[model samples]
Target: MSARPRSKTRATWLTLLGGTFGLHRFWRHGLRDAWGWLHLLATLTGLAGLQRLDAFGIDDAQAAWMLPLGGLSFAAAMLATILTGLTPDERWDAQHNAGRSGGTPPSGWGAVLAVIAALLIGTTVLMSSIAFGLQRWFEAQAEADLQTPQRISVPR
Candidate 1:
């Protein structure tokens, strides 16, 4: 038996809000999909890594461990959102809205919102990564400068 028809609007919302946790995938494919489980696990692990960073202190070298986890979660979420948003209505209906009556097509607002969300989220993530890199670089530079001996100049 086929799964019941799923609404693209609801799916898009889920993908936007919880794509990293695979809630959207679970909505699409149910609980048995390993990919969904993987997404969920990776997201949770990433969250844990973030907590670890906070617990360990931001300046601690170990805090860097969270960077990749955070990046992966953000990237996965963005990808899922984009794919769900860009999918044509007929295709979405074929893959997910099968066996149902006149299925609702995605609204223009949904597409527009998805585009906006993707841009905002993508930009935030990119900016965050660049900031993290700059912070680390500055910290390293400070440490190196501290370690190097400074020549004392006499005012002549």
Candidate 2:
């Protein structure tokens, strides 16, 4: 690890802005972190899902399933941002900046702003994903009902 102290503010901002790509994880754990690679893979998958949706349109069956991967990945990243921002400075310094000369300086307003933004964005993404999935499911069910042949009853 480098002798430089890890700034909580920078970590919080990275989590907010690039957590889906695992930038925050890379910052904390260095390049070899497996989780960082996983984050990159998942983010790429999510982007592919978006491309599929754009190419096939929302009604496409594959797109319907694929789009949620992006939203969920984003929501999880926002949650991580919130958690990182909310951690106490002392604890953050001890855990991430240990052996550094001065330890991490106070995060101040930057961490607070990151937490607020993450909460707003995360909640919106999560709710929208749920609503979109449910709407698609119901539409599919309705379409199926309409396509099915109805049975006629005769007087017995």
Candidate 3:
């Protein structure tokens, strides 16, 4: 049996809203796919770890592991949404709409939405990452400065 045609617009929305949980993947590949489940698990675990760290005020070292998982998940979701929306209708139809009797699926501003989302989300994520790195670097530098002794010279 041939797969039914899926809407790129709807798929883009699902990826935007629940890509970390692999909702888009489930929509495309069904619930039995291990990749979808893996995405879900990783995102959930990362979020849980972050919550725990925040609640307990854990050390930065402890929080380090969680950030990668969360950041990776966020990047993947945004990128997937962008890619899905930007994909040409013909290619999308060939990959996902083939064999379906349904006429042309309406794309409905998919490219526009994708471009907007990519610019907004991508910029925010990139900025936040840079800020986080800067904060960590400053903190480390402050620690080092505090540890170093200041030199004093006696004047006649």
Candidate 4:
């Protein structure tokens, strides 16, 4: 089978580099497949929760950096996919070619997954500690309140 000619209009290059900034969707296609568009919607919901949990210092009405991070990850994944399709040399020729690892990009998913797991475990432990402290504080306050009970109207 004949090979498709290399695109010279910079779509490939833009898609590869724009991945870092998450501009690939707009470069490859039109405005319809915008990367940050749908990403922002989902991030908004997460941002609400983020605020509730005080994850980030962002205001309740404002957007969070999570939206941009999501888009960037999308771009990274798609560009890596495209790179895996081409030969090592061909991929190197493409713009922003992250050195081909045996003709394939490293599976960054594992790293992301591991980091997520670590963060979850860490947060759980921290919350547990904080809850324990709060529980003790509440018990002490209740004891004090009982010891200093206000005199009520006994029998008229």
Candidate 5:
């Protein structure tokens, strides 16, 4: 096997920061998408909508938060794809590989995985804290109820 030629120095960091603008997409393999960038923009901006959705009986807070987070990750991935270029199919020989390859594709999916793991851990911490607070509240209520007993009188 021949040595892999180096593409331009990794611009992934730029792609990551400028994902909302889709700057990464342009440099990776000469690709572009305005709508996907729009989605990223929406994910970045529509965070308030997620909270209001809760008032409309969408009580699944985790899902509510996660959807937007996942959307952001998806947008980031799109940006990453734009920035990283799609993976090269492995059928070509050295010359074709040289033509087709665009440096090592930044692992957009891997980045998404890391984001998900961090979010999950954060969610768990928040949920446990809430649960602990609720448990304490109920315990306090039970104590109050025990201390304040109903009285009964003898009946004739």
Candidate 6:
């Protein structure tokens, strides 16, 4: 550890702004953190999903699967932001800034605002993803129904 005090507000803001890239993880746990790398990979995969959607369009099966990856990644990042913001100052300092020169600082409005923003953005992304997935599923079911032949009963 660098022995430098970590600010809860900064961590919260980082999670809100760069959680998709694992910036907050890297800030807290350094470059060797596996979770941080996973975050980066997930974000990249999500970007790939976005590109696939752009090229193939919404109707494409692959796009349907791929696009949600990005949305889910972003929403997960927002959740992380909310969690980071809500963490108590004492616990946060003990975990992140133990034995540091300065003691824990009180979390201010910045963290609260970040949490609020995360909630709004995360909810929107999650709900939109669910809607998109359901719409695609329903469309596929309708198509399958149309393709299947219905048996006719003869009246004697």
User: Which candidate ranks first by TM-score, i.e. highest?
Assistant: 6
User: What is the C-alpha lDDT profile of model 6 across 1-156, one tens digit per residue?
Assistant: 456788999999999999989898899889999988888887787778778778878788877766676678789899999999999888888788878886766998999999999999999998987888789889999999999999999999
TM-scores of all candidate predictions against the true structure: 0.72, 0.88, 0.75, 0.29, 0.30, 0.89
Query: Tens digits of per-residue lDDT for model 1 on 1-156?
Result: 554567776777788888778887787778998878887776676677678777887775655645655556666777778777778878888887668766575645776587579768966875785687578778888999999999999999
* lDDT of model 1, residue 148: 100
lDDT of 4 at 123: 51
lDDT of 2 by residue, 1-156 (tens): 568888899999999999989898898889999987887886787778778878988888876766676778788899999999999999998798778876567999999999999999999998987887788899999999999999999999
Question: What CA root-mean-square deviation does each model show from the true structure?
Answer: 4.6, 2.0, 3.9, 12.6, 11.2, 1.8
Candidate order by decreasing TM-score: 6, 2, 3, 1, 5, 4
Which digits, one per residue and each the tens of the lDDT, describe model 5 over residues 1-156? 454643322343444455445555554434566655564565554444455555554444343444455355444444443434333323222323465434444344554543454445445544554564455467667878999978999999
**lDDT assessment of candidate 5:** 0.47
What does candidate 3's lDDT look like per residue over 62-102, in tens digits? 45456556666776778888888888888888888878867
Q: lDDT of each model, Cα atoms only?
A: 0.73, 0.87, 0.76, 0.43, 0.47, 0.87
The residue pairs in collision within model 4 are none
Model 1 TM-score on a 0 to 1 scale:
0.72
Candidate 1 off by > 4 Å = 1-4, 59-61, 130-156
